[model samples]
Target: MRERNVVSAQTQLLSTVAPSQSPSFDPDLGVITPPSNGMARSAFARPVAPRARWRRRYLACLVLIDFVTALGASRTVVALLDEADAGFWDQRVLGGAVSAFALVTNLVVPLMWMTVLVAAGAYDRRALGRGTEELKRVARANVAMAATVSFLALGFKKDLSRATVAAIILTLLLYTLVTRALARVVLRRIRRVSQRASQKVLLVGRLSDAMAVHEVVTRNPGAGLRPIAIHLPHHPRPGERVTAPVPVYVGWDLVPLVQQLGADTIAVCGPASLESYELRKLAWQLEGTGLDLVVVPQVTDVTGPRIHVRPIEGLPLLNVEEPTISGLSLLVKSMLDRVTALVGLVLLSPLLVGIAVAIKLTDPGPVMFRQTRIGHEGRAFKVWKFRTMYTDAEQRLEALRHRNESDGLLFKIKDDPRVTPIGRHLRGLSLDELPQLINVLKGEMSLVGPRPLPTEDDDYRGDVRRRLLVRPGITGLWQISGRSDLTWEDAVRLDLHYVDNWSLVYDLGILWRTASVVLARRGAY
Candidate 1:
């Protein structure tokens, strides 16, 4: 399919060529070309020197710091070993003096660790300023290096001290990760304050597609993709600027535009609907230019691990792995949820008792509120929470239905009349939901999953119901992003995204973000 499209584009380009010679036209391909070297030099408005230099300098400094950190960790390990009792674990490893072993481990091992990091592509420019991926690679590289070294020592029958080797490897891994994290923080700060550190991006797509990408990049400054302008292939009005979230340009004379904006990257979205051949030709034209080309697929909210590309013949096929429904991973998730919930209930028993007493005193009603809610696999369960409303709150719900401010099947208001004063405080702090830990212990809920809906709400069907495949949670993406504040569509989108991409690491990250959001009390009511 891609090859045919490319061939079709080539055929179409032949018909558009001018009869006479033109500077921007390629005679062999019969296609319009980018600006010639002399024209680009004359028309180029922005210079790329400063930004390129800043990027290179930052990468170099980061690599140097990481290597230095490895050395420091190695030295500390050696110092600790030197101080240990002589008879206590053989100071005579390698059949030599402690100083001799120290020299080799401190110098040689640190160098090997640094080499491993470089070989792992930790210093690649594409990875710079990116989050988590780089750190993950750093840790992986250290682990691989440790395993290789340990294996070699055992195979060669070398008299290496296991205690010293283990200590040094552990220290090196810890030191490298801490230093890289700190470095990322400083570099991200610099990227925000220094224009030269940010990568200028030129988006090519429809207004809506470009705007979507623009919003994501703007929201995540750490991504470092600063949108300077957008190019609309099918501009409604030629030679007229369209005011989008950013400046939108028309027509396909992209080389001069790229030069003018000094863009470091050109991000093309699929919605532009360019022929495969045209995109290939554009990439060819950009070969000599320093701009990096990034293709943004139309598929949204998919994680990197699930999306795979397989090139067959001349076409690239995207294969999206189905989300895991039942596996060892699910078992791990269940175990963690139950263990954490049990421990939390025990630890917070005193606080829970106090909350129960307060609720009973204030409302003179049930301390616990029980309501039927949907759970995994569409199972109905009685969800538990500390009662936050009056005894007759359910009866008055129909009268207050017209006051619903929350969108979708969920009904909520900023200041619901049913909520008692104590209830309002508890809701604000999310303390009212603490009793749901019992649900997690009972295996009716998870620590992190989609929000369970009330049994009365039957608005979900089709893909939306897939959220039921996993155990519902007390808090999830919906809670961390915005609870009642998010629109119905956005809330479902986030929940579905989590359903498809949930992993142990991903869950941990969400949990960390959840902590901060809970404290800030943003969008809680």
Candidate 2:
């Protein structure tokens, strides 16, 4: 009877506590989770997932492992530099002709070591995920760090032979890249196993808001959150916990129920007095006792770069800024678009001609295909491509609409019948998009931007239309990120991320990566 009375009272208190702040605004909007139901109505659109949160212990462990591994790798490189008699190791060795230590206690080596780690972002919690990009980042950071060390060594001391440094650099680069890749694979595997043993969390919040958080953690299961309870703050009392018999006492005896349940995490859905200082104090009281407190909002697909946290009058104020492509930098972007596109068109003219001939022979179509697509400012422009389909491809589109495998407003079929034999080959090699260079030169497109959607007026939400802020790209963050394999939201997020953080350095990086991705053919079809 006492337990029942307590439960009834707790439910009544929860029913009355008002949730604070806006219910729908996303703090960051680029990294949200996609809808699991899978149909997308827009070419480029933000996700429904919250930005990922990670376990501090796991992150700290990964960082420590990476740091030690890097130090050891650095030491091995240094030892090799010492052992190589051909002035390779001897020069870079502490007392040798190539040493950076002539100035201090291997200060340069240590600085190089730290810089390499930092540049690789091995310390970042987000990079713990097993992905090609994470490994690439680590490899790039190590290479850049070693290169900095070698170049600085050479510049400071003329007696230093570049050959020794070069050899050591190449050897270390290969070793480090391979080593990091293997380590990530293993760590991720181990993390997966550990995730299976993760403590289950029961969350209660607004239906839509809670659903977003649920999907986010569920999608990235390795993050170690297994949500088992879902109480709707709007509903006051939840039916029951999903995986365990945990009682969630909201408002009244909330602290006591949390204590009794021995929950590892309590992710309150909305900001109520229950989620305020008292909740934080509850978190503090439970800290050493092993319970984690989490508060997730409806922030969808937002990245940290887009969300700025400011301190105003003792409150944690959030500033969500609008991103745009402007200033003199657009000039640089334009210049790069023109130069790369012109060079691409010039070098590929022979191949283009060959493809054109093949398409003509096979499909009996015009040498070029032009389609109207939405561009920067939502303006319509004709996008050009080497004709890789029958001239009547548009007329046959209706039959393939249902066959569209792409999960968005975009239409694509893995074995599209409209693709002539030659066209399929060209698309596989990304050669069909070659004529887009002319569009770049004509100011209707760029070498990189969000993939443009056709201008036939497919309906889109206001959030989905933001990709039009920049000219459509022949190849872009989306193209290199996954191309056809990317979900609609991923494509949109990558596009928006690029637009928000446009930089000349990033463009050059993308171009360089684009070459590798083309050769690798990660998402051609």
Candidate 3:
């Protein structure tokens, strides 16, 4: 496993590419480097640098984490080794049997387990880069290993204590499950902490198709794609954002397309979805070019759990499962939210009071800030929060616009004068957003959904704005990923994704993710 040399000292990021370094056409491949040492080589080079080395490092880190957890958990079995239960007696008897078993089991099981991952095609370089999918793979691999080991032990008449074995199994499984997930999440933030993940890829389709692909990928920055140019077999319609800012090329321009864009991947999701022959040719052209050819299917709002890709005789088949949401399922969410939110409100009441008091003392203002944010079906209602700004912050908004750094309808600044001293701390760790439990109680909001947006122009927001289809939440996908630091486009994308894929099980995951995000606070500002 390659480890990205983590730069230990605090340092500021410098731009890797010059402003004028724009490629002549969108990249067919090779624009972003693997995240290296968390350093931006572009900061010093000609805007283009070899970065496969960086990817190697990031992948190595993930492998190292999984290895440590599995190896470390194996050591914990030493504790259960203490002074002996039956079937597994003294050091020599137990030791010999267990040690022999351990050696065989450990060696065979891990490899077998890892083999399952390989069989499942779980450890593909690209798949491992994405967090959620990799998590499922890790869990699946561990479960398979446990089953195999248990069966083997039983057959050999050397079965250890069920409790000890179970503990060992649980520890091994949990460690892999957790550490793999952690490593993926942490690597993303740490690796891309300083530099943006900008992939140079070529768009293969009509103008509308190219534009749609660009929009979708842009909305998911964590996906790590940056289309530098476009490829059109023929002229696309005028007024289509076919080449917005990025250059577009014709079929005859393949050589320039590769050279000018420094493209590392050819993203085919356009009319080519209908063009098998050209798609094949495009794949052939990209071969040996060190550029990946990725074909994006029409699948949307679907997670790995519901989608299975199988290849039979070189024909790839994609299977999308029907949604599991049912009436009883929704009830699970409502009940869970109500119980959890209610208990949380009561348990954290003292902390809430402390926040309110601090806010009042800092700004001589209402301890709670209330503002109408759009909720389900565009219902307007005030969401509550411990005051994180001066009482006059809104009234003084006009003056702060010049300082606004957030790129979207939302306003955000890392160090806003409007934020009280206490507010900054609350905002950092997210204590400031706690008062929305009241909104949940009132049925004006949900315990989890998109962050409700505030609007005043219309009688009610529209469905495009209808993200209000679900009740708003106190913390959500947006909150966990980044509160204010996210681009406006990404904020809505997550909200819509959440709305499209809402489930009780999904909500539980969101809440868990929210805890980790809070501690890391990568996007707090």
Candidate 4:
């Protein structure tokens, strides 16, 4: 009777708590369970089964789309081959034997392409909403498929148009990537409307650790894991309510709780909270349940490519590969940066001239803004920008310091008196930074890298100074993420992430996202 009274009172308190704050609850150790029916429409509950079915059907549609895309690509390639190499087709008529073989090859190519996609796990539900990794897997599968097809033809001594096959595979790869990108955009919109489609997660950890992981997951909705409930087996204050947005459950029996909540994922944050025996028991209980067990390491800012899990003697050991700091690849990146900058300057000369003319006519000051900035290896360089502030803006900075909106090491104000009338619009669209293309050409920066800090503000130490290993960029991860809207810690984390994992493909992805962010004018000044 006492235990029942405790459960009832805790449930009542939870019901009264505001939705914005985390709920606090008293631990109920006895058989005083929450009402089963109430679990269906709790603030965190959703129709999990229906959403799962819908996703399966959605993935099926994507598979059909890929199948059609492969067929179309093959036929298009054959037609191009016909036009480019007419003699090859002409030779087919000699007994019509070659023509029959050509027809067979065309039909087989698309089928093979579909098989490769399936083998790649491109249509897997888990891979659907997650970013880049899905696309990278698709690329890898197509490349491997192409190589396999080539080897088979060589080994069998089969006569075939290798160029046409290569072209078709390339087209298929591109089509798959483009369609998947569109699907992700649509999926995000659907997820916003039908939250049930998001991966439901059961968070099991300390209150502090749960909250930290919660912040990351909530911030990146595109990453797809949604915490529906939190399990604080070791809540510091048993009788005190924990402040959380989701339902707070006390004690661990994670398997039973997960089954009751219909959670698709169980996220265990931090290593210290769970014992080896408990984790092993939980893993055994989770077998055949179809629930994904995600153990999030305390280490932050690590990406998928760096992390590898190797199983030895029934134990999974995680290996994090160290990033290479220098190589011939860096030389190639530099060459490409200079070439791209040279081309951009020549093409945008008229726009640059117009901006200079506008600045001269609008404000009686120099058309360019040159400031000393810390670059590679902490070297100082005079970075150039299209002037967007009044001449006395520097002198006016001290008075507006109190009104700064940014946090931790950065100063930003939504509305600053120092900005000239014309400057506001320019900064809004990021046109003020166009002059930095010259910096790229001058070898002080790359086309894509960490954002450079002002020389006067440089106080980097230890790991923070790693950003100086490569040339700073005109635009980068920080630019696309939030610009002036991001906190100082977030900016540092992103810069450090880039420093640890810099690749040409990553640079291109950043450049692509930069275009979208710029056009949307999101998180701009």
Candidate 5:
């Protein structure tokens, strides 16, 4: 009897809350929408909303940039070749002046380049302004353009200058990449300042799942998803309070709620209450709404390169590839690390000498500090760095243990009296760690990887041991993210993430960002 009363109350609530021509609802199938009142129009029939205008404008800007880059590159290369060889375009071919052929070729090249890029999905809105996928697509499109040009030249029996063609392709690739990267920088700046630039997302799932999704969104502000509200399947019991930053709503009929909130996206995070049929019904209701639906998967800490989507019949399956910890990539990384370390040590020799002299003058201690650290596969190696602390700093450590700032096994203090006056400046600018290049050169460390801990702090068990799979590094995700300022848990999480998703591209990105982080002195001593 109570169940029937509850059902009656829910029906009455829906009737009172929804519009007069609201979609039909089923007790089992959830909110089912009929084709009446334009609720079920084709996706193409929907008009573009004001919120989506920015995407179209951005796309147009990219197209213009790419077209200009291609034309400019071809023109510049051709002009340079013409200057070097006066008769470059003088030879007549196919009953027309070669100059005319060259003119036509210049115009046709950019068009062909644009067409190939469009076919390769280089300008996909979802990939723009984030991730390495956009750059990869652009690279693939450039390769395709080169191949097409070569095939056409050979098939037509035309003696095209290979140098000019190669130069044009290479120049276009470099220019387009630079322009796109700059565009992303500008877009990120704008989105950071104006919340209106981001997509208003309505989270729909259990409270825990919604909170997890919120945390992920918070961590990645560049994703541009601003959580407006959370919609749960049922009402909270008395004394139960939601701690999420967004407002909370109850009930399964989320279309009207989403519309009312003016949310442009709905993020369904492992909806426990919605069955397959109900989920489909919800999608049906949003067919002509011009809204984006993002279903967040349960997977965590995995990147796009490792995940593959395979569909069988009508079911979509996600296949995650194993992490690459060995093979040719590691060999390349090792060679690069040693080569870079050698060059850095040679170039910075003068600065290193000056620092050594200053350290000798400031305090009475050794110029270099070497401490045993846990390395790959539980091996121990003496890591090298410029001495920044007093000679008796270790002896005085126990007295300061009670005042340690870190919550985990690592110990850190924002302003330690043990540091010498000159040491403070070196630590702040990250110059104190320059000596570690020797370790990198010696194969005891890498240019980029998880930071190795001292021997006493080594707890190589469970997932923590994964950090030992590769050589320790002087700088890593932890360094670029937040050095000593990060909590132990956050630091470990970042280290593990780098270990599981390490790539040459990823290493380069971290190295690039490290310079900015060091300049800003973020989370430094």
Candidate 6:
């Protein structure tokens, strides 16, 4: 009788709410407020989702940053040119056009740049604060701005200086990228701390699928998804226990449940019980609720660049492109690797010589250590590094094998007795691996790829052998991620991921991150 009354009251409350009108909740008063125009009260109105709020805030921040960056860049360029040329601003180009040009540079340019960025979708919520898409858009927008300026200058016969145009564009691009990156760092830190700053996700699916999604969102807090609850399609059997980190619910009536739990995002993962028609109906139910529905596809590991969505009739088809292991891009990567390796070696020769001298003076062993390691396509090559271990290190390997702190084929010891005092410092700073730049120059290795393993650890087979498809590297995803601290499985996974997603841009990002990791000495022995 009590349950029926409760249901009746809920039904009456919902019936009173108009289809188009959403009720507003007062958290302090714990009641739903009617529309300001004196409309009927609603029980279904929810506050704006935290995810949406944060996204709006972030987007506004980006717009402000872009505008400020563009303005600053323009002003800086104008100031520098004026100072350098002495009469740069005063000079008449095309009959006393100095004032007009000044107006364009000071006011018109920043607005035009912002317009280009908006049209390029740099400030789109989906692109903002995630991935390289935002950065790429900003770069393209700058290019477009440059082209537009050149076209206007040519068409109107305006005496626009190419140097000034290039300077403004370059400055804007650099400033925007740096400011956006710093903004992302700050936003990520905030999201990591404040649960309300992230999307409150309600997971709906089979237990296993839900758990998988849960693990992913939990692992990446920067994704800004906080799982609030799990909703199963069916109830557990008698005496059966269902264990979950979040609160669990069972039923088809998800609207009320979602509102009650304050979940703004519904993630449907591997919907076994929810068929096509039912899923469509769920979408209909959520139409005016201001809630976001995210469907998790089974496909994994592939990134956005590789995946293309094609819609035929109403069915969406996913087309996955083959990894770019070879071709023009790989050729470019190879060229870059060799060129960078050459430059690095030339610049660091003094430091390298100093390390070599120090090792010889203290360790009483050969300065350079070479080991037979597997390289690209199972080719055996002698990997070079500054010797970090004593001359008798090989002999003591068997005795220390039992004390190996690493998992899988790799052998590592945090406090190995074989490492000389100077060697330990060199290893900690990753200076010992500097000589591999020689291998990179020789085409035997890459500046960024899988770490080359010694002959004894060569157990490549199946998908694992894919790591050998590319030249090994001095530093890679594995090195920057955790190095010796990562488990063998994790190391192999990272290596394979790098191999599968190899790109010049990805390599550059890893190289950039590697500097910070090395400086921190994280996971290094």
> What's the lDDT for all of these models?
0.78, 0.62, 0.65, 0.78, 0.80, 0.81
Per-model TM-score on C-alpha atoms: 0.81, 0.62, 0.71, 0.86, 0.86, 0.84
lDDT of 6 by residue, 154-234 (tens): 999988778888899999999999998899878778887775467789898987899899987886687778997777776
lDDT of 1 by residue, 105-214 (tens): 56777778878888888888888767678888888898888888888888998877788778888888888888887887787777667744778898888777887888
Span of 10 residues, lowest total lDDT, candidate 1 = 26-35
Q: After superposition, how far is residue 15 of candidate 6 from its true place, in Å?
A: 25
Residue range 22-46, candidate 3, lDDT tens digits: 3222223212221222322121223
Model 1: number of backbone collisions: 0
Clashing residue pairs in candidate 5, if any?
Answer: none
Off by over 4 Å in 6: 1-53, 92-102, 147-159, 193-196, 237-239, 271-273, 455-458
Clash pairs, candidate 1, are none
By lDDT, the candidates rank as 6, 5, 4, 1, 3, 2
Least lDDT summed over 10 consecutive residues: which range in candidate 2? Answer: 25-34
Encode model 5's per-residue lDDT on 56-118: one tens digit a residue: 888899899888888888888778877898876554454577767676556787788899999
By summed lDDT, which 10 consecutive residues of candidate 4 come out lowest? 41-50
| TM-score head-to-head 3 vs 4, winner | 4
